[model samples]
Target: MSQQKSDYIDEVDVDESWDEHPSRDELEETVENLEDSGFEVEVVEDAEAALAFLQDEIPAESSVMNGHSTTLEEIGFMEYLNEGDHDWENLYGKVFSIDDDQARADARREAQTADYFLGSANAIARTGALVAADLSGSRVGAYPFAAKHLLVVAGVNKVVEDVETARERLHEFAYPFENERAQDAYGVESYPAKELVYRQEGTEGRTTVVLVEETLGY
Candidate 1:
C-alpha cells in the first residue's frame, strides 16, 4: 500500500512558518533571481498545472528517471510515470525491476544520466538557491551534472528568506518530517547524509524549477 502526505503529516511536528506561502512580490523576485542564476523558471497555479507543464514539455520517447520525492507523489507524477499512457521510457521502473541488489544499484546509478531527472527540493531560498538532502546520494546525485536535464517541482512552502534560512528549514523543518516518514515507511531511521546547496546552473536549458502556488510537499 502507498502512503499519502495526509496519512502522516499530522503526526509530525514541524515549524508551520516554513510552510507559509510567500507574498506575490517575494515570489516574483525569487523567480527573477532563479532565472538570473541560469535556471528556467515557471510559476504554476497548482500541482495540476505543474503536471500539465511537464506533460507538454517532455518529448515523447525521452528517457525519464526520478528520485524518491513526496512532492512528486503529491503531484501524481510518480503514479503517472509508472502507470500513465505516456510515450517516454520510465527508467525508474526498469531499474527497480531487477531482483539482484547489486544489479539494481548499478542500474540506479546508470539511470541518473537519463534524459530527464525529476525530483523536489526541500527548501528554496528567495535568493534562488535550492537545498535538499538524502540518506544516500540517490535523490540528489542528478541535480549537479549527472543527468542531461533536471526538472525540480516544489511548492511555495519550501521557499525561505535566504540560504541560511533554507538550511535551517532543512534541518529544523524538513528533516524531522522526513525522518518520521522514513521510520514509518521503511522501518529505519533517515538523516541528511548527503546535502546539496544548488546555487546555479551553467547550462542554459539544463535545469528548470516549477514552483507551485499551493502547498503540497514538505
Candidate 2:
C-alpha cells in the first residue's frame, strides 16, 4: 500500500529560522560540546553508516525498546526491528503482541527500562543540549533516566545555534510533523504535552548520540 502524504507543513505556522542548517564548523563545535557534556558522540557519514553503527553497537540477544521516531523509521530501524533476523529480544514487539489492553499498557511501561532504548531528538544545540517532546509521556519518559542505555539518533540539520533555538525548532518543526503523524496513525490531534531538554549526561557511557551528516527527521 502507498503511504499517504502529510500536509503538516502547510497546516502549522512556523518560523523559517527554526529550519536553518548549521555549517561544517558549527557541526564540529556541536559535536565537541556534546562530547564535553558526557554524551558519546559519533558523527557518521550518512544514514547508511548510522544504521551500520547501530547494528554493530547493539549486541545480539539484548532487550531492545524504542519510542516512535521518524528518524528510526527513515533509517529503516523500525523495519529491521520488526522483521530482521536478529537475536535481540524486541520489547516493542512483545508489547504489541499482548491482546489484553491493560496488560499491554503495563508491558509498555516496563519496556522503558529495557537493556537499550533508542530514539531521536527534535533539535540539538551547539551549546550541547538536546530537545524533544511528545504528546504522551511514552517516548521522552525513558530518555531522562529510566533506560539502562540510551541511543539517540539525529541528523546534522537538527543542530542549531543554542538551547533557545533548539526549543524553537521543537515547536516549529517537530511538533507539526508529530501532530500530523498522530492524527494519521491514531485518528486524533496531538500536542507537545511532555517535553525534555537534555543538557548533559551525568552518567558516563550511559548515552550515545549518533549524528548523521545528512538532513533527517523533523
Candidate 3:
C-alpha cells in the first residue's frame, strides 16, 4: 500500500531522535517574549472569531496569499476571498515552480501591494516564531515576507514549547504529515512528497499567530 500526499500533508513527522519536547506552558512563555519584543500576538477562543477576523480585519482588497494551510481551508478562506473580490496567488497557481528572479520580483512587487496575507505556521513555537516547512521555492520565503499584514492561522495542535520542540514537530509531525497529504488535496499520490517536506531554507518574516482553542492538524 502506498501513502498519499494529502494524508502526509495532514500528518506530522514523528521523529524520536530529537530531544525531549517541552511543556505547553513553557512554550507559551517564549511566545510571550516574542510578543513583547516586536511581533504581535493574538489568541482567539474559537473558529468564529478567526473567521470574522479573517473576513473583516484581513483587508478585503488585499490579494490573499496562501501556503500549506488546511486550517484556512477548514475555515472557508477561499469563500471569503472570493466573496470579497480580492485577488489571490500562491503555489496552487503555478506556485510549485517559478524561477528565482521571477519569484523575487513577484514577491517584492506583489507583497508590497497586498493589504493582508493569510497563511499559517507549519509549527508555532510558544516562543512566537512561526515555523513553516516549504519544499517549493514559491512558498520558501515569498508568502511570509511579501504580505503586509501576516495572519498565522493555527490549531491548538500546532503549538509547541520552543524552537527545539518546533523542530521536533517538524521532523516528527511535519515530515510524515506532508508526505501523505499530497494525494486527495492535490492528486499527489506519493507519501512524504519530497517537494512538500520542510528543508528549512531560511528564516520566516514578520508573522502573527492565531491560536485556536481546539486541536487541529498533525
Candidate 4:
C-alpha cells in the first residue's frame, strides 16, 4: 500500500512553517548555544561535506554503528559503510547480515556498545537541546550513554527557537514521515514510544552535532 501524508500528521497538528530553514544569524546563535551546552558542533556546507567530515572523525578499525537516519543516507554514509573502503567494523552491516532472528537481535543489542554511533536528531533547539523519538529503543538507546562516542547529524531546517518548538517539529514533521516509512518498510506502524531530549552533554567530547547548511532529513 502506498503511504499517504494524512496517515501521519492527522494524529498531531503543527505549524507548517516549522519546517523552514533558519537564517544564518539564527544558525550561528544555535551553534554557539550548542557549544555552550557542551556539544561539539560543526557547520558543514552540505551533505557531501558532512559525509567527508564523518570519514575524518572516525578512525580506521574502530567499530561503528548507526541508527536509521535519512540524513545519514542523504550524506551517503550508509552506502559508504556498506560499499566504501572504510576499515571500521560496520556493526550495523554485521547485525543485518545475521540470518537467525534471535542472533540478529542479539547483534543489534551488542552494536549499541560500538566505538562510534551515529544518528540524526528530529529537532535541535536554539537553546541547545536535541529532541528525537523512536518506535523502538534500539536507535536512541545508545544516545544517552551506551555508545562510546555519538554523532548526531541534522540539517539547518531542524533548528528551532526553543524546546517547545522542537517538540512541535518532532510531532508535526518527523513523526509523519517516519510513520509512513515504517509502514512501507516494516509493515508496521511507528510511534514515539521512546523519546530523547538531550539538554546537555556532561562529558566533554562524548557527543558531536554535525549541522549541515542544506535541508536534508525529516
If scored against the real structure, what TM-score would every candidate get?
0.97, 0.93, 0.66, 0.93
Model 3 score (lDDT): 0.55
Which prediction has more favorable lDDT, 1 or 2?
1
Best of the candidates, lDDT: 1
Give the Cα error of residue 120 in candidate 3, in Å. 1.2
Please write out the lDDT profile of model 4 over residues 24-99, one tens digit for every residue. 8999999999999999999999989999999999999999999988888878899899999988998988999999
Deviation in Å, model 2, residue 9 alpha carbon: 4.4
Off by over 4 Å in 2: 1-17
Clashing pairs in 4: none
Tens digit per residue, CA lDDT, model 2, 108-201:
9999999899999999999998998898889899998999999999988899988898888888778887888788888998898898999999
Model 3, span 72-189: residue lDDT tens:
7666664555454444443233333455867755654454435466666666666556566655543435443555666767776676666776766766666556655654456664
Q: Is candidate 3 or candidate 4 better by lDDT?
A: 4
- Relative to the true structure, candidate 4 reaches a TM of 0.93
Instruction: Find the 10 residues in a row with the least total lDDT in model 2.
Output: 1-10
Candidate maximizing TM-score: 1
Local distance difference test, each candidate: 0.91, 0.87, 0.55, 0.89
Q: Candidate 1 residues 1-218, lDDT tens each?
A: 44456667787886688889999999999999999889999999998999999998899999999988888998888888999989999999999899999999999999999999999999999998999999989989999999999999999989899999999999988888888889998899899999999999999899999999999778
